[model samples]
Target: MTAILSVNRAQKKFSGLVAVNDVSFDVREGELLGLIGPNGSGKTTMLNLISGALRPSAGEIRLKDERISGHSAHHIARQGVARTFQLVRILPSMTAEENVMAGAVFARNRLWGADAHGLARKLLARVGLDGRADMPVASMTYIDQKRIELARALASDPRVLLLDEWLAGLNPTELQIGIALIDDLRREGRTIIMVEHVMDAIRTLCDRCVVMNTGTKIAEGDVAKVLSEPEVVRAYLGDDDDA
Candidate 1:
């Protein structure tokens, strides 16, 4: 399959500190590409670059062959790229349905009024929050808030969905449900880049994996193979100490 998104030698610097350094990868159309590494490995930074939340200091990001590196976040969202934050972000003052409607209203195709409301309800149900559409986001549990965020991301009908540790804080049961929901999205042919620490989810969901360390890519290949690489092991576990 052709690449739906490409990060060409992307780099991001904050003052003199390099947050993401010459990281390059491609997310194929309909493939769930895993971006995994230790803390401070620049995974979220990479997502920010792709989502237009941060402009790259060097290199470029392309979506369907269109350069989007310097574009604004809203512009990127309006261009069919939607994302869920590592920490769930929602409109605290908005009802579940209204929050989701915000996505549709600001999206690429832009829905309105009843159309947005209808889509919001459908997405709320899709994320398993059926009758709670009238409730404020603040009243929901952490996992439920996650569901709302995912539903909101989907409301835009995004071509590429960026999931930044969407499964981070779930318990065992919730993890299963979260994995299944993501699997359903994958089966529906959604192109996704997932930044995760959960190895089980990485093995279960990703078609390929990209491993990063200290802001640079260390490995890229099949999940099992990449996980077994010596450098990848060192990046995560720190040099066996005896060796």
Candidate 2:
């Protein structure tokens, strides 16, 4: 399968610290790829570079063979990329639908007025937030806020969706709902690259997985095999030295 997105020797630095170092990977079209790592292992930084929130200090990132590393985040979004944050990021003062409408307004071809509102309503309902559309996002529960943010991301009609720990705070029922939603998106052929710590979801949902450690990719392969690798285990659980 052809890759929908490629990170070719990508690197990022902040001051003298290297956040992402020579990380390279390919995300095949219609595949759900999991990026897993211990804390501060550069998974989120890699996502930032791909989403144009940060520029690579070296190398390139491409979406459909077009280099997108240096482009503005909005420019990349218009190129059919959309993402949700690790923390919920909705317009707290706005109604849930209004926040989703903001995303629709910037969608490729861009919807407006009644059309945007209609799409927002549908997206909200898709994420199980139908009746809460008019509620201020700040007044919603944490899981509801996450759903609103997800609805907003979908309002952009993205071909590639980057999810950053989107399932972090969910209860079991909500987790199942989130997993089902992702399964539906995969069936629709959306390419997804997710930074996730939820091992169950990664094991069940990822077509393949990449493990990162100290700014480098330590392992990449089938989920069970990758997770069982000694290096990956050490990265996550520490060696005898830490004991």
Candidate 3:
């Protein structure tokens, strides 16, 4: 498989402290890559950098063979990248259909005209929100809100989707549903890079996992192996000697 995204020596700093330090990895086309670590481990910062929400402090990021440093979020979206946040950022006043249609407007660029509404309807149904299209966002449950969030990201028809903690609040049943959705997404050939805290989802959904600590990569391998490593335990549990 070819690499769809590459982060080489990526770094980020704030208040004279390093949040991400020389982290590098490649996400292959049509594969699910998980970025996992303890809290404040710079996972979401990396996602923001890749999706153009934040600029890297140093090093390079590439989409395919073309370098994509310093591009705006809109520019990055137009380049076929999309992302969902840990928190659902929806317009509380908008109905479910309208929220998804808002996304369709950008993704299809009005090519669909009245058909954009139709496309939004289809996406809602695809994500199991068919009956709730006319409902206001404020009326939906957490899981529904998340599905809508995903629908909005999919509205862009992105080639690469960066998901940050997309499963944090889901119940076991909902997690299973998300796993099915991720599988379907891969079947559709979408390359996914996710920063996930949900270990079950990460173990079941990813092809390979990347582990991080203090903004740097510490391990990359099969889920079980990485989870069992001393480095991973120390990162999550902490070493008293360092304290």
lDDT for each candidate structure: 0.95, 0.91, 0.87
Candidate 1: segments with Cα more than 4 A from true spot:
none
Clashing pairs in 1: none
lDDT of 3 at 143: 88
Candidate 1 lDDT by residue in tens digits, 1-243: 999999999999999889999999988999999999999999999999999999999999999979999999999998889999998999999999999999998999999989999999999999889999999999999999999999999999999999999999999999999999999999999999999999999999999999999999999999999999999998988876756
Give the lowest summed-lDDT range of ten residues in model 1. 234-243
Error of 1 at 115 (Å): 1.1
Following a full C-alpha superposition, what root-mean-square deviation does model 3 have from the true structure? 1.8
Instruction: Score every model by TM-score.
Output: 0.98, 0.96, 0.93
Write model 2 residue lDDT over 1-243, tens digit each, in one string: 999999999999999999899999999999999999999999999989988999899999999979999999999999989999998888988999999999999987699999999999999888888787889989999988888888888889987899999999899998998888887887888889989998989988899999999999999989999999999999999998885
Please tell me which predicted candidate would have the highest lDDT against the true structure: 1
- Candidate No. with top TM-score: 1
User: In candidate 2, which residue ranges exceed 4 Å CA deviation?
Assistant: none
Of candidate 2, the 10-residue stretch with the lowest lDDT total is 181-190
Indicate the residue-level lDDT of 237 in model 1: 88
TM-score of 1: 0.98
What are the candidates' C-alpha RMSDs? 1.1, 1.1, 1.8
